[model samples]
Target: MDGSAYGDIVAQPNWTRSTHDSKWAGYLKSSAPDNTSRRLAVYRGSPLYSRLDHHTMSRAQLLKLALPLVKTHGFTREALSRSVLYLPGTPHAEPLSETAISALFGDGDNARRTLLDAWLDDARTDMKSAPSPIMKDVLASRLRRNEPILRWLPEAFGLLISPPSGVPPLDPSPALKHVASIADEACHIVGDTSLGLSWYARRASVAAVYGAAELHQLASPATAYEFLESLLSSSSNIENTLVNTEAYAKYIGRSWAGIIKSSGVF
Candidate 1:
């Protein structure tokens, strides 16, 4: 999923000691349960061997370059194309064409979803680094980052869940994944390391609160904080009742359905 288009520059004798050793170390560890050495050899033989430092960049790299442009271009393909212009070194002779953009990101709504996911991931990263480890403050910081692209978010949310004309609606897993990620990250930040049913409850409750708060922000930006606080006030009860995995899943589903309905994005 995170492969890069560019190939390696100079093949190193020791693959483990390559410049991207640190980056791939975790990958190697995770894949060690399988035949790690054989997999490593295959990757070394592959074109993407020098992916970390190459003339061309990965989609993740391109998206990172494109993120700042979202403020001006509102998550359009134009913003991604123009991202090449703002690359640290010399700019590309021309922007990426529609075909190239689609290939790099995806076709139709998938492209926008990819961009939205990248922005959300970046927001989570920012949230992780906040000075305050408090859940409320961390979530507030996460919501604040959305202000830059708030105008386009409702449309983004719709595209994330709605399919093209004549196509069936897509699963809202991506949106749900991001919400879970935010909830998980907030728990990690707040040092909530409980196991068992409580883990599921805490995450589900946080995700529900954040989902509602974010939608409330779209309608009433000024009072969203107050609304969030009110939701948080009752989160304990919500968590207690969501101990069952099925119940927690339903809670999250309802939260997201409400978000879609209230945003008029369905």
Candidate 2:
């Protein structure tokens, strides 16, 4: 369910606007005039439901579309409850509110990570299914993973603990090899040196060492050691805490351990 689906809707906008008298599920049915051009229509709209404009999909339609995804994505009341994806309840059970569902989904790392992996997989699948004969290039694959991780890991790992919803910040450790791997791969995908350079400049300014250098054990050991010495020097302030945070620690400790373990470099 994406651009193509929306395109089909837009190709024929025959949806009747919701009048909000009774909460009935909405729909879009296509009656092809010549198999090439069809008149598709939507029905049973609700005031409580939000409408998708690209192709006039009603809340009922969206919920139905999400049914399969929800089922595949561990359909706890969490996602639907938050309205991230609409899920409706009729005259029988108490509807789960957004706040309650969000609280549940954001409950713990295990839950969040499980959700994260699921999202990454979904995004990956959608991207791979692009109509433009999606390329399986390394960069595309990396970006698929990177975008989601950067968008979610900060909160999941408690990096950007109070980040805004949907666009979470990256609080990942600089030493995390996967961070460098993904970033590099994403940059390679865009094939734009300027953006890549800009990205490196931004990450390196505050980071003790950037992802790539640290991950492949290329951290200019001498330079990094010198920088660390300077960082640890006479800074009896919160500034000290900033440089030695979770991301940096994970990069140096866990990520390094992983790389070493993987390479049999023990």
Candidate 3:
């Protein structure tokens, strides 16, 4: 991992003191030093880890650990509004609003677009006062890397898209139309779906190169936006395309639900 990337993961106050670290320490003390041993130790120690362990614990042990953590550390509106990150500007910092967080975590089709636009808008504003072209990209990169709820957005999106039990069936046309409109708007905001692809691909590639723990952060968004682009670019009739897309989307959505349920929100 690059120094800055590693710093991003460890920079938060008391991150080293998190329970995750304590568990790692315990595992290392009990196990021999080797590649497989190290990997097993880390995996066994991770709070995000999930598996069935009959003798030591039981099924869904990780879920049990995560549920209580979520309840205890749940995000608050005031706390979110107060969050800030340094950027290239006279003030050298940008404050993210609770509304932005809500929109990103909200159930609406436009939520992703809103979240991306807000971050890009701030980056553009910072770029105007930036001393160099490299600084502009730096600002944008930092914004994405340090984005609040980066770990939770996918789970939130998963929950949002999940079908609610007992809801009556309604016309699919309007919902499909709304999704199309949101896709157009997102493309407009970012210039094109190609640019969105580039943006996500860059993040994913960098994270992979750096061996970042949160690969899903990039994967989930890339999958979702690409799916949207595919829907728009398909030449098939709207009804047919919507039918197939809905099925595919539901499948992907269920995968995310399983991920969330297994891994829990961070």
Best by lDDT: 1
| Per-residue accuracy of model 2 over 1-266 as CA lDDT, tens digit each | 34444444333212122222112222322111121111122232432224334224433233333233333343334434433233222222544464544454444343334344333333333333233331224323323333323433333335323233434454344224334433443334435354433455423332322233222223233353344334323232433354446458768898778888999877
lDDT of 1: 0.69
Best by TM-score: 1
How do the residues 127-202 of candidate 3 rate in per-residue lDDT, one tens digit apiece? Answer: 3233333322323333343244455544433433443442443334433333333333333333433343344433
| Model 2 residue 24 lDDT score | 22
TM-score of 1: 0.69
Worst 10 residues of 2 by lDDT: 30-39
Candidate 3 deviant stretches above 4 angstroms:
1-147, 162-182, 190-266
What is the C-alpha local distance difference test score of each model? 0.69, 0.35, 0.35
Clashes of 3: 0
Tell me how many clashing residue pairs each candidate has.
Answer: 1, 2, 0
Write the candidate numbers in order of decreasing TM-score: 1, 2, 3
> Can you give the lDDT of residue 143 in candidate 3?
31
